[model samples]
Target chain A: MTKRQEHILQIVKDHGPITGEQIAERLHLTRATLRPDLSILTMSGYLDARPRVGYFYAGKQAGTVISERLHKMLVNDYKAVPIVVQENASVYDAIVTLFLEDVGTLYVVNQKGYLAGVVSRKDLLRASLGNKGLEGIPVSIIMTRMPNIVTCAPEESLFMAAKKLIDFQIDSLPVVRPAEEDSRQSELIGRVTKTTIARAFVELGSEPFL
Target chain B: MTKRQEHILQIVKDHGPITGEQIAERLHLTRATLRPDLSILTMSGYLDARPRVGYFYAGKQAGTVISERLHKMLVNDYKAVPIVVQENASVYDAIVTLFLEDVGTLYVVNQKGYLAGVVSRKDLLRASLGNKGLEGIPVSIIMTRMPNIVTCAPEESLFMAAKKLIDFQIDSLPVVRPAEEDSRQSELIGRVTKTTIARAFVELGSEPFL
Candidate 1:
């Protein structure tokens, strides 16, 4: 269901047997525009309406708005292409890639395009300041390898994926889908970054009501 | 403008000379529910309607959906209370505050509760690893002092404030309202953190669409 529908459901739950015009007024929408949403709710068994009595809440009250949707929003719906580098790429080249993409983290992919490792700005910064030349040194030497690198599947809920970012205190998570034949080997499909979430939040906040 | 009103404006732009019923059908709302939005748009000079000819688009195309709201969304509308400490507090206390709050950064305030400096996890980590006794050292000694601290006013836009966070590569920004008597001192009213933005985005993304 759309957020609007969920909101409408909440309104009906709070004030059952309310008129369409009243719901529209509360939401600053025309009764006409609210019809589709009203129809969906009634048809879905979440709402009940009578010929002259208006609409009434039919859904259970256990589900809150956020939880109702959080479990269903998959990673693939919003994940974006990630900036990646070969594990063999020099630390110097890794730094250049980081600047070019303007991303704090970079996913290191193997030659076959399989998820390999992850490198961050702090890793590069430490490498750059070291007396040792970074010209030919591979990122694999400093990158956080598999089993240590946190990842999420495309099928996973964005809510869980986002929680991982916070729990790990990382800026981004590589979205990987299982290989067609082998479930053990995951292919990097996209990325869910802090910026992506932040931009989404800003858009959400602009709404008159949640 | 609320997202719904924007949608109505967009619908009018894309399919002008459309009746209220048509708009209602397109949005699944009833005519009565959509009246207020239509009225607001018409009065705001964004839309034009005739006696029986239906609504027409009157706004320019260049001024699109986001920019119109971006410029007007004040920080005061979304800012939250900031995690802060006094400059005279020990580095040990600052470290405790950082872990206690589970925040990436901490705002250091003076005796009067004015923002004095900013301390980050990296700062605490470095201080803790040093041989010097953290109890003897004040947070002000290691914190990023004023003139170096990047901040935003409660009057600024979230878009502009968000840009600042990305441009500066920082995790949080202190939301300050300008002082009435002292131009040099700005009162820290709240904070705009990347996590705050992230949580918002996650909520936004969960919605089917605006």
Candidate 2:
């Protein structure tokens, strides 16, 4: 987010029910410029912006407001659309689907749509070269096992997901709900990849309207 | 990295002793088409090209081999040197430095050159609005504590540095020596930021060398 965006949040937090024009003036930006950001935060379920009225810090103000864009871009937005691949699919098929989708990784889920093991391009490629018949071998043979799988909570920020990819040196992250009290598998919610983070960063940094 | 680059790595990893002709035939690309990638990778230290023999992987393979151009572009190789502010400096001074440097953040270091904390553009802007006395307010009051700082290893991948920024929701990550068991503070090294990631991504995704 821009420095002006942070200042806007602070203003709304400190002085609620303030006009966009005032914030624009204070930040040396145009109301037209601020409108889109306000709309985005509102759409992401953070700040509440009202027409002819003003904006207010909403839903655990400290956590949301400005950085929600950062958070949403990380994991929440990716979780908004979950991608699934059957656990029994052949490794080659997974690779094909990956390339076709232009994604660096794919999620392997159980029949119930719960997350099983995760597979990535590197894993699949490595498996393909193995003497083992990859055409007959299920992705399970090469998949990154549960617990070894790095995941992100829906409420977590994009920064967190990006962190996982970087720290783990993996290309993608599976977005999953926390596992049930006693269950081994976490709910398969969605997926996020390095490209997702890169795209979001571009999106946020891009002055599309301007 | 592009799919072709990855394909080459996979080829080397799968059949290390294989020749360039074999890879070109395997990928169905003419040797001429692949020569540029080979030259680029070899020049960047990702691959060691033998005069008669084919290319072989070189150095430590870290997850993936992003091009040196991408590395230089994304890690802010040109502008990543950390900007230090003396420990006793006021938040106002930090603001002037940030503006002068055209950077999003600055580091706070003591007389002994040990890292104390960090002051970001957002922090300074927030402090600026708080009160007239902010000019006298020590940066330590507003800076994120040192022990809480996120960092990167020099040998780390660009993706790793990106993770620190995204995960912490902080604008900058100081690269540091891994802290010792008994110690709390890490030795300050270099710095990474959002702009670095964006620049690198753009370069990596762009055609031709950056």
Candidate 3:
């Protein structure tokens, strides 16, 4: 930590639960000089000042939370399970299947079963409304394709999964595993969800160390 | 919900905190017939039963977790804050800068302040060990560049951010806001990070709803 950062934190610790003006007054610095540091420190996870309020130390001391820990805790583990749909299945059949399956989204697969694209319930609804000739329409038309799929390996941690969810603004990740029978065959294994991450986080926060 | 699914959940709710066999018996189902459905339900976020014992409703049913909330969260409300290093700055200077700043990564920017690529602490560590001529090396050579930058709009919700993080498995999200003067001039405004999301989850779990 810089000498200035140390001073800033020390001031917060000693007279903390204190306001920014109070910090400036004690440190012999202007509020403007303190503002950038306060923003940086708070954003970096060192300071925990509420908006329009003064700063305070987020933890007993700073410098432990890493992007890696955040990734594991929030992502790699807590996602939804994925199911693939074959192209031969009719759109109506697919729709009924999904309703029976009760899933928000489904993956469209090629004959060899590689990921072609994804179909969300909304897409089906939109297609139905579009008069795109539902019976003649295939899911491939609306699906978001590969290089676009946000996927992960099963071995990665839950926090990694969470970071992707928050960073890219997606709902879930497809977990893929190489099929033993054929090296090129990748199977959709599981999904990590934001809700799962939230639940895990609750469990973790209640822990003493974490 | 399908009658089959309702039946399955009911059996678990009634006999469970009980075994899968009991659920099978109550539903007049073979253990084989119920296994796949049980697995699918558990994986899809509907049921949360433990293996070898029985299942329980383990997802947002206990509380409206982030995934449930994610359905309504948008993509434009967010801002991605990026960490940048000056062009002329040496690797040593950058290292000290990162350490003092308490940030895990930094983006190397050109003179115009447009993003170049990213440089992580790990990349610097690897650079340090090799005799790759550190002093004169501009931070640019090591960065992960433009097309590589996964960005989000100010309108995005924290859940959307979570999805990106999970999909890409990246550490930080550089939130961007459109420039007032030029529509093409998108600039860094805020950042959505793993720590930030973790803190949010912690905050969510602490709510009285749980």
Candidate 4:
């Protein structure tokens, strides 16, 4: 879509139930010239125009149209300090950390502060129920390894980060900086929880009314 | 803000790094007429204008400027089928339901399908660790009862529902239908989860790049 069309979508999203004449006036354009753009937006499902109420935003379609503001928001500003545990920590200790921190996932960091693995409450719960001793068992045995762990860059938008969480069905993501230009290792910086995106959405209030 | 001012904000938010001339052209207005609207939006913390890069969104303020789509989105369309259990059910049974459904919170319902209370994983965990017989203990003993439960109506906006969850620091909200105009009782129909809001935010993506 053209930049003008995207801008038009944002206008409808922010101030809807607006009339064509008003939209034209806001843009300083003739209603005749603005009509095509409005029609395109409506036909594309990004906007909806009422007979007398004017135009409003339609709900999302497959591969939703994300706004530029959200597309540019950096993860660093929104990420929370990650709750971490040593790789060798015992299951009992991890459970304590989980409750004390009130976090759904924990990052397992190596001695160098590089992300080693990840562990969830379900992992701890399952380990606790088995015959193995909670204090004796190291978290490494249950933690998901680095190769399988999902991580996000500090520069990525909340949109992409949130999509990763939804696509993978995970509750949180570790925000990291690449350790070297070519290395696979990364330095864990912060964490982005589902709550973070939810809070932002509440503040944004851009979704279509159902 | 005036409709014209809000529209100007949308323009800057979507096509930032765009010149004032470009904004004027898109809206079909003279740069002179658009100048005042731009100044007002920027001064109000809705838009940010750079000397070289044009304009951009200014992130959220105290009373977040919510989008019309979000203000219109009702809970009925987004709420999921509520995972519920009887208040009289055994604690052991409640745990089973929690795992089988894979939900963070459960709505405790009375005999008439009206919401009675709410139960969380922490509540069940604490109840199970004690000397009490899990099979004999009723959820009513541990669940948070009515009047204290946080809930939303199907007709309410997702914006309001999301605010409630954030304000209360809760993971989920039970969507209910009022039993009577004067009664406090409501029949639980669905649930709004953090995951749900997070996913919706990703789709919305109207927040500014911070």
Model with the higher DockQ, candidate 1 or 4: 4
lDDT of each: 0.74, 0.63, 0.60, 0.77
Candidate 3 lDDT tens digits, A67-126: 323334433345566666777665655565656665546777788776667775545544
Please say which candidate is ahead in TM-score: 2 or 4.
4
The list of candidate 4 runs beyond 4 A from truth reads A1-66, A129-133, A180-182, A206-210, B1-66, B130-133, B180-182, B206-210
- Candidate number achieving the greatest TM-score relative to the actual structure: 4
Q: Model 4, residue B84: what's the lDDT?
A: 92
Query: How accurate locally is residue A85 in candidate 2, as Cα lDDT from 0 to 100?
Result: 79
How many backbone clashes does every candidate have?
Answer: 19, 5, 65, 9
Measured against the true structure, the TM-scores of the candidates, in listed sequence, are: 0.51, 0.36, 0.38, 0.68
lDDT of 4 by residue, B1-210 (tens): 777776776776565546789999998999999988888776655565556546655444322223655676788988999999998998778878988898778889998889999998767755654224678889999999998988998999888888998899888999988887436688788999888887777666633321
lDDT of 3 by residue, B14-127 (tens): 444457788788778899998988887776555655445456543222223333344344434333356678766777667767766655567766665655566765556545
- Tens digit of per-residue lDDT, candidate 2, span B1-210: 578988897886566435789889999999999999888766655565554545555433321122222233334352378888888888767766775776667889867677788876546644554256656788888988777667676767665566556656666777666446425556677787665664444333333311
Q: Which stretches of candidate 3 lie over 4 Å from their true place?
A: A1-210, B1-66, B71-81
DockQ metric, candidate 4 = 0.25
Share of native C-alpha contacts between chains A and B (below 8 angstroms) recovered by candidate 4: 0.41
**In model 1, which regions exceed 4 Å deviation?**
A1-63, A207-210, B1-171, B179-181, B188-190, B199-210
lDDT of 2 at A150: 85
Candidate 3, residue A210: Cα displacement in angstroms equals: 26
Q: Name the top DockQ candidate.
A: 4
